[model samples]
Target chain A: MGAEFYHSVHLDVELCKGCINCIKRCPTQAIRVQHGKAKIIKEYCIDCGECIRICPHHAKSATYDSIDILKKYEYTVALPAPSLYAQFNNLDDIDIVLSALKSFGFDDTYEVSAAAEMVSEMSRNYIKKHREDAPFISTACPTVVRLIRVRFPNLLDHLLPFAAPVELAAQIAVKNAMEKSGLPREKIGIIFISPCPAKVTACKDPIGNTYSEVDGVIAIKDIYPLLLPHMKSVASDPEKCSVSGRIGVGWGNSGGESAGLLTDNYLAADGIENVIRVLEDLEDQKFGDLEFIELGACNGGCVGGVLCVENPYVAQSKLKKLCKYLPISRNHLGDEVPQGALFETEIEYEPVYKIGKNLAESLALMARIDELCKKFPGLDCGSCGAPTCRALAEDIARGFAREGDCIPLLKESILSLSETISPNQ
Target chain B: MEKNIKLSYIVSPNDFLSAGAVSEDVKAHLEEMEIDSEIIRKATLAIYESELNMIIHANGGIIDIEITPDSLNVEAADNGPGIPDIEQAMEPGFTTLKPNSDMKAKGIGKGRGLSNIRKCTDFFDIETELGCGTTIRFGIDLK
Candidate 1:
């Protein structure tokens, strides 16, 4: 909970032009332009990295874990997301990527995609047994889960109760490393190679879960530059790298999870704006027969993440080709659910931004703002330092700005006062 | 009430793309005013259902909104074909629009719109004159 305030995404004030581009693009309306710079209201932000992608000035950036962070632990294991495979073009072998990760001073590499397959299998049975009126929403994307918590509080019950693939893989990696090296659990560091800022925030301040098993999060963009030097020469043993089923590798792209379910009656949407619209439809109970609804905040799933190097379309194509070639998983962890990794705790709504402290004050404020909205122009031109005309009205009601702050209103008042003071002058 | 704010909008017919513009506007206004989150959500859902009904069923309609200290009120009047039996229409899963038809393909007339609107608001009322038009009034109390 304390780590929610420590967002990986940050704005460089010197580079911001205050053009209102980010203010308009943010899905949560967490950004505001003030004093010729943009400010992020920490509580409202879900760290989806939408502003990072839309900012033309490149003022917003995702922070990555420095290489030095791995020095503390005796054993360091790299748990790479499947999106990492989509980063390099024409990469035929999974061992090449795993070996390249080992060259970066890691003891072993674990495939998060393997864990993804297990999760998909678990979800198929969960949806079958615990049926509800609404479709079960996938909790794979941390940003999407947080969106449900903030916007659709009533639909929290609809989310599938299971740990994300990355979380499960991190715990598994740590356990395996401790067994192999005969070291204490605290000595093993399981670092996740994440494709988005949301994963970084999730690792630090996990939602629903008590604590995150992962120790550090390094952005995929940061590792891409370092791995280019090692991809040319790799280990010969293919068994050293973790390889999973084709369905798991396909999870890097949108609709991949739904396809794994083998169910025709499902809905899949990508991108934050599109996800919001789909959630609204789901709230209306339009897709009554839908067994699952897979939503990713990125445009083309993790391949289109803000912190990734490759283009989403090109990466999606590569991911598909790789999925077609990979063999299915033979190893099975039969019906037993992992003890610490299961999502057993109930997740409560995080109403970070409420109108007022109490009921009466909120009602009074609403009445005051309604009265002020009538005076402002309804065009929402954004001429008065606010994103919309209604925002300016709220500003006036909150006593943050004067009503005359509007340029048009100020001019009209001045012209009327001059005429009234001197007749026919 | 010490003060009252009134807003009116004209919903264009068959503009499936822009059907939710009015509801979105009202939701934004409620958000800016720092209204209760629960109340805003209920009002927005009711307005959204009303807007979709006006656009899909009726050719077009006039949406009149009134926001006061006590409650948020919306009155939608459409000149479309009015329902002969109000009781049956109010029942959930009683959609007149056929599946995969023109209107259903556009994702409207789910038969849950009226029932959903009724569930979201504290006060719900509808009056219709068979072949003339239909008028629906609903309010969600902020208090």
Candidate 2:
């Protein structure tokens, strides 16, 4: 809402090779490699950060709070993603990481998942109360939310209304800090130490919201070394840490939500493609009576996030070990939750790519889409941004795109030197 | 009243990879044809189950598809042991083929194949002879 154009993902012009790899990979067909570089259609991008992970050049990047920006506030609160433990190869004690975050210049460290416990309890009750007619989608992952916004708009009603662990943690921390010490909201900057760019974008333009509560984002990688020394200082004391129960902290991976809620009909799937397929099943009314579905953008879930230090393989074990016998989830009964704070209420949704202004116009647009497909055919090789050439034609038909949106044609035009060749000479 | 034009595909048996090919093709074509999303979804689901039937029990078959202004007709005919009892087959959990095509010694097994077809396509029809073959026809109206 800040700019109505705030982006968490961007293509670094210098790093991009104008390759259509991301164009092909984007499920929503939100990208178009027009001119020389790839451009993301702001309206179409759900900010899954699939490009950031897939790009070989490291060209696609998620924006994070600058190191210099830390100076703006009187104090910085570093709320590390639970995925951070997975980033380390042999890290055992959560305290070590907690101490290290202190070294990185933070007044205190908040385990974001601590608040997720409250969310877990609340979501469980919410699902139970609305069991019969609810198709509540998990709200833990921003990329998944974005995917719903751009691709599965029809199922938005199914998305459970809860602040993600990160948002919840931020709100709790802000509230606790204000109560404990009379600090102004502006004076305390709640910066999320994120494992993936999606979180950065989430904090920037949270889906289901007019504005994000997260003020800034810090990449775990940027602060990993800065906090390592503090881990040495606090090698013994476990009391100073925010060690959340395994069931709550276990929320990082696929199926974890169900594992926590303990619902028989729940489903959890990771990876953008897998999530989309599951969403399709949900849209088809497959899990009509199901209680919940957990979807993660990365393959093994957050452990698989691109920015983490450890491979998803190892994080799997670390997270498992950390949460082996998580305590019976504490009932935090809703804390008089503010009326306007929910992500579901904050974010607004309209169809991702409207076919037309009105029903008749939409019919006309469909006719146009048919014409375009007749011209382009349906091999969705992503040579065009619309997934299939057929989809591109439909966009053209709907007046959302044009023939010039195709990069191949532009490439051929340049090679043929159609504009520069001097026939008169 | 409906008028339709369709592109048919012949599915090959035991080709685990190409099991869902026909449905995939129909889905792509519907997009190209600019069919309504709801209509495309219903037709695709119906055709997918029909196509999978040819793969699972029919040892492969030809899917004759007809697309029209008002409806879509998909007829999957195969050269395999015809259904011994249409009533039992129609009932959910009565899979003549393996359970799910995936978990079976073959492919795609959740026993949801026929039930899925019933759940998807409207105007379902079936024709078969004991040792000869089977023919199934279904239509989806574009309302």
Candidate 3:
């Protein structure tokens, strides 16, 4: 792994209490409390925002472009994610939101859900054509893709070789903006109204593709308040701006992407933990003859992102209600899948968790870790700053820590030393 | 320097909930050693299938695992009722599970345990005696 790996989720040193909450909750074990503060190993982090969601002190925050970014370009397009539709009280019409986006200072508005429908169509055809490689994992969630890239090496071939809907939407939005406004590509900003920090990192440092078309990413939470008043003003005479239908809007909730594929053989799992379990089972070939695997790092897909404002279940129901009267699908692709929609680069696995540089060194390190583990108590108390006792042993074996770091073992040694030196009292 | 790591686990009888715990532990170790992903998958699958067999059929068992730079070796031994027909038991879909057993409800006994173990390992052997017990041994080459 190189120093080029970028992470959007960062810690606020002022607010951190150096608690073990983040270290324990990180699915990748990327975080560790050292010297009374949490340090995130950049190579190990997937920018999944688990620390952001778990931090009780509000010390963790995601980096994204502010609303002021609209002024940087002559023409700006707001690409609203489907989860953005689920944030309002009674948003029966998607046009109201789209019109408000225009009122919110963007020159034009594009729905990411529209591109999602196209991706769904492309995936269905891909699955049918690649029957030998039946179970393709969804790459819509950047967190899931990064997780697979670092952890699950055996399942790399199964990743759907397509750009995320937001990426495709940005490309189309930029192309349309340049043609309509008679401006150069740089002058037209393709901004994404994102639901999570993973998308921000994905745009900045793309994995499957060489570069992302998205110029800037703004969080839904930051844009929620500004759009509300605009939404209220446009509700009465909203422009007919919604281009997507039920299948597209359904992408907001868990299992929504799989549902759009129109297949009962697919399996959809949400939340990072559940996604890891499914990937592990898939590696062992546990699920027989599945067509597709949809994984969301958040609890209820994009709605449960740490950057979103509404409760995920509430947003899910609202999304269902909003899509109730809409058509099955409004967007349709041609007989051939578009070239721009596919990934241009291959995603290679990064063995960040490997204990050493090679097999011989790794064996030596593993043996030393095992030896250290035997000396330390098997209590997985995070007092040593590591998540588990075994993790502490690994840290010791790597020379990043020492056995004296174990508070319990250190206490015992100190007590014995005092007892031996004091003589019989 | 060459070093061989050894591990052991005692599988409790009918403990369906925690049956795969040993295999998960072994898999974690292999992951730390940076073993090839395919090899880790095969090793874990074979261990998991053998563990399930001990819990579902044999009255618990003891599993011993040895890992070296070149290979992974496992021996699962149990003193439960021996297999009456070795040939039939090795066949796919050949299970002694009752139609309405508790294991069936939990989706455990699919009759693919032994066959899957054999399929995942490079070397596999089984020994059984009518009045005694059954022991299964398997190995996968890491190189």
Candidate 4:
């Protein structure tokens, strides 16, 4: 739970009935059933929080920073993911949100989306360089990237190596504060107001060869109720605007990344399974002249994060209207801040993912998978306690769910348990 | 000694919805074994494509999968119209499926069923008569 790793998705012991719901739906086969409850396989888990988001029993939950951490920073910047703007209802202006943020002890609020604009432009340029492809694969969604690492190791080379827009935003915010105030880096802590658990996990365990640039991640859902009390309506006057309105916020929804980056021959893919399909096309070199590809592991992208506060569809609309009028984030924040600043420069790092030929290991895993397959009929009926057919397969592989975790087998076990009881007591 | 799970199901023709049922079950079994994704994908595609072909063209068939520790062996036999041209059908995109029928939910665009099954495994054998029937045997090395 410390800096070793940040896992936002967890099984709430009290709520979980030891069902395999999360186990079945995990895209990477990261979950397994143990003692009748679903558990996370840390090494395999990318922390996408699919279990947290899909659990109807509310057994799955995410971990984030404690509100106590706020006291550590002398000056705080509320760097909200663009998706945050999409959660509220009856919000007329940005000032209310800004003021509300101040009430929560933030000295100033910076838009993560502002840096996202530069990301948009950067992505466009990167895609232009690789336009002769089906999909270039969006680097913005960390969950989607992790999914690729586990499932499609062959396509790792196709991913853009740049840090995500949120990383860029955090880097810029920290550097700007460092240069402007000359404050010690420790005194000024940057807390990412994330809409998704994947971002939180990414901040904790970065991928593709670099230490994470983010200090801490706070899911927006945790702070929404606190901010709602101080919220007020802001006039639509452009003079009061401090950054790109929703340019960065637009990144919360599916297809929003592609929309944010104005480029031709671009394909936006949402949901882990769908992204896998598109990646296959990319592997085949079928989609030529493809300038860019945006992939989000969740159905509605960041808006659908397990830790987010509201309905994904509803949040998506809010983000759309919020950024509809604001200038792109690049022009807004980058222009306001002076050029030649340290924040504008990019930092280099090594990718965290490992690439090698482990045919022996893979074969062993496959053999185990075959053994697991022998247990269930692969109905994907959510009866064996796992959510999908593939997930049940993974559960067996991880030694979480037993081969006899199948429903009929479970029933037989229960009946046997009952039969073994003495009638006379 | 573990009892050999000898189970067989007839894959009737025109039953597209249920085409992958047995294969899906087999996949679940494989997953339970903690098999690697590559092996599972190979087994899945090979069985799934064969099942799809059985429903669309063969009118129906039977599949027998033998689960063993060393390896998994699959025998899928179809009774409808046999593949008249095995060599041509092995070519990618050689299916007799209607253009619209080619589309699947997963969006796989490969044209060669036999080729795909072959590519998905280390060994593949097909025996078919023009009017009698077709039987395919494939093995995935467990290592």
Candidate 5:
């Protein structure tokens, strides 16, 4: 209703087989197979990339900046996600990856993991000061933040009000680039190498914050092959580019954020379903004594992103091995939260799942949906283009669909109609 | 005047796995109807606590929810053994659940179910007979 919500996940119509795979796998039930093609209900989409991971036809793809985007600015600084370090095999030094990024045509590189360390320090202080709020939910994962914005409004206040690591890195990258190159803000490109599509959406349409510092986002998979050759050249004499240490690089895996907090009284859950369950229980005030809740939309955290090349578990182990030799943390914020660290804008509840406009109308429509639910089979087979019988009923009540769309119901009605028109033999 | 929407669910006894299904469903429904978040939160907690009580103590029960424009009324009727002392049962940390009971093992049945239900809802009522059954009624104002 308000311009269709921006989503990084897209359906390549030419490749789509209209299979029910993505429709069933969507955590938010946003996908519907209509007209023999999967349609994402934009408002309901959190850009979790579950569809991209589940689509058999490979039709579901994420939208991101191409290699040509590097040419747009006078000076471009690549902000590599922590997950990027986990992509390489036997990647002993993080400088190898950073140097490779620079050799691959980037004017400079800033490790997002470095900024993650700063964020971790800030989060520790925030949690200590806001003990009354106790279990503050991490706002690093854009998909998790977006999911909370829509579905779990009750826990909105519990969200950590800080910019994500990549965003903080972008802000710092842009500032440093501007001072060094004597260039205007528009001339400097602070591009992020992202592990997931949700970051692309975060850059385009940010939540919690008013504006995103990152100019463009390129999927890790896209940049993975191009950087491999550069990695070999820079492996022997890599630049002094690594600023982050263990705590920062550890952000690549699940439980890493909580581990960074250095608090045993925290709960960390990964995978979208698990995150949802945590949020649901949190809303019920289940975890009373937890100091923080770290929720990642991806299974093994950023390393498990849909755009990553390596296996998530393998990547996690690689990340652990890489961090073993690094320092505890390289970045530190003594007493004050840095400027641009906190969210400038408040995240509001979207209530996208509401059935009707007002209370009276919603009640009526809900009643209608219940009545329709009684008529339709409860198999949730997804043949009617909707995920479940209840979803179809909601669609029908909203006038987007009809009961006739249900194949099984149509068959029954047709059989009864024929019997009424022509007496039984 | 809008007609009240009535929803019902049956809580199975000692089914710790599916204990919170009804409350979750009811919460989702209320969210779809665009109910006030605070009211939904209160209603969900109350319903969840009552549902757990039915599973842990009352063998099983039928939970009926009546949703109107201004309020939500819930009635959890159980045919299992009823509460012997309503006054003592109303106190927090007075749970009859043994430490090894399935619910207790799952970190629930903390004796706060009844108190929590009463604390969260606008109105709370309990009717019980030692051998016959028990019914806990609660309501929350939606406005």
Candidate 6:
């Protein structure tokens, strides 16, 4: 909660027409309208890019490394997310995409799907071994992981304590670049062509892992325009591209990883709100039959990322079509997790609910808020600029707003006060 | 204590979608009051479990909550079919509903709710009457 690293989603203050749209849409309740502007509460923010998607004024934008940032390293390797393959039409061959990345100035392109395969294999083994009472949750989506830390802190132990596919991809890319180019580790950079902002935040300031091998993150949308013409041109020799099997590339959509796990009783939920409900059920121990749960913050999965150019459903169908072309006999990366690669770091819960400095004061404030809540209409109209009726109650209790601020309540009070002041008596 | 705060919620039966709404509201209230994190977690978990039980098993009842500087108390009263044996119901794996019963069909009854509620609260009690209803009263000391 201190001076942390950069968040993926930030407000373009100049363009912000603070309409309170993002505040209402935010699943984490991280956005607040203050002084006619929207501000993100960094402690509760998971960098899910929901604000970027919901912002009507185009005020919210995700930050990513430009192609210029990749120039600093002598050998820059681009790890294209599987979602990137689904971005183009009539491009069944993923090599064209890889080749397009190379033409876009990356020294080489590595398939992140391969790393995803490795991660999936390792996860299956882990799930089998760690057969505890609680179901194991996937860690591939950084936003979901952070959501657990923020909202569902009780279920933190259930999260699969593995490095994200992006991290694994970065590590492999860096290692491969160093081995092939004979460049020092510092001289080689691994840039992840991400479908979402969460990956960028993960690289900038890793949550679970102490250190990240990923040097930079570039959104797929940023690289898509440049790669379109290249993709249309001569396709790369399919032999040169490092391809992954159906299981790995299928991760762009929901239930893809669960299918790879080969588990009969696994639950998969996509989109931030849906994932939240699923996690609530998990918290209630409602999914007693399930052994694993896969949650993706985006609607369809990474393909539904705010930064993606393609429709999630279209991208999903394209990825599925490409999945059929994968050879029956495919290469699988060994689950050789680099030393110190696993996320052993303790992620503390966000303290958003803390009300008072001391127990006595907090109890008093809680009582006050409850009292205030009873007086206000429970309409949750959000007319008072608060997200909910309860929020307005807290605002009034905390002296940030007033009872008169509620338009309906103010009208009622005005009528009553006028009646009392009238000379009818 | 400046003023003892009280709240009442009428939880609807079979309303699975909004089963935990009351507990979430309580959590938000306690959070706004800045209660201790550990205490808040215990209270919210206990409240949520109790709320779920009322919705899934009972004929949807009312929950009354009273908060003081010293302790927080929640009394959930439901007019559904009462438990035949309170002791058995308190067990971790004991549930009145059959394995394929209505509640179990919806994945609601894991037989862990009552035990979890007991474990999370400092004080727990269940009062039930045959052919009548059940009332669960629990309290957690803020101190």
- TM-scores for all candidates? 0.88, 0.78, 0.97, 0.73, 0.96, 0.88
lDDT of 6 by residue, A1-425 (tens): 22373577889888887687888888876776766778887877888888898788999999888878787999999999999999888777887888777876789978888888878878877888878754888888989887787667668888888878878778778778988999899888888889999888888888887678888888899889989887766475533675688889988889988888987888889999899989876765555568889999998998999889999989999989988978622545455655444786776666555666776777677777767777889887666777776777776766777887776799898888888899484
Per-prediction CA RMSD (Å)? 3.5, 5.5, 1.7, 6.3, 1.8, 3.4
Off by over 4 Å in 1: A1-5, A235-239, A358-360, A378-385, A395-425, B1-5, B26-49, B56-59, B67-72, B80-101, B104-124, B129-132, B139-143
Q: List pairs with backbone clashes in candidate 5.
A: none
lDDT of 6 at B89: 88
TM-score of 2: 0.78
Query: Total clashing residue pairs per candidate?
Result: 0, 23, 0, 43, 0, 2
Over B1-143, each residue of candidate 3 has an lDDT whose tens digit, in order, gives 66778889999998888978989999988887768898999899999999988888888989999888888999999867999999899999988888888778777777998898999999999999886779999999987
Compute DockQ for each candidate against the true complex. 0.30, 0.11, 0.69, 0.12, 0.69, 0.50
Winner of 4 and 6 under DockQ: 6
Q: For candidate 1, lDDT tens digit of each residue in B79-108?
A: 899989999989997888877787766556
Give lDDT: candidate 1, residue B50.
88
Every candidate's chain B TM-score: 0.94, 0.85, 0.95, 0.86, 0.93, 0.93
Taking the tens digit of each residue's C-alpha lDDT, what string does model 1 give over A1-425?
Answer: 44355567899999999878888788887777777788887877888999999899999988778777789889999998989999998877778888888887888888888888888888777778876644889999989988887777657888888767899899888888988999998898899999999999888878878789899998888889889778776645433565677878888899988876768788889999999989876764545677889999999998899989999989999988888877765334576966655675787767664555654565566667766777776666655667666667766766766777676777788899999999698
Lowest lDDT 10-residue stretch of candidate 4 chain A: A347-356
RMSD of 4: 6.3
Tell me the spans in candidate 5 whose CA falls farther than 4 Å from its real position. Answer: A1-4, A421-425, B98-103
Superposed model 6: Cα runs more than 4 Å off = A1-5, A236-239, A328-336, A396-405, A410-425, B1-3, B11-18, B27-60, B80-121, B126-134, B141-143
Candidate lDDT values, in order: 0.81, 0.72, 0.90, 0.68, 0.90, 0.81
Give the worst 10-residue stretch by lDDT in candidate 3 chain A. Answer: A1-10
Residue A13: error of model 5 in Å?
A: 1.8
What value does the lDDT take at residue A182 in candidate 6? 98
Number of the top-ranking candidate, with DockQ as the measure: 5
In order, the first chain's TM-score in every candidate is 0.92, 0.87, 0.98, 0.80, 0.97, 0.93
Residue A253 displacement (Å), model 4: 1.8
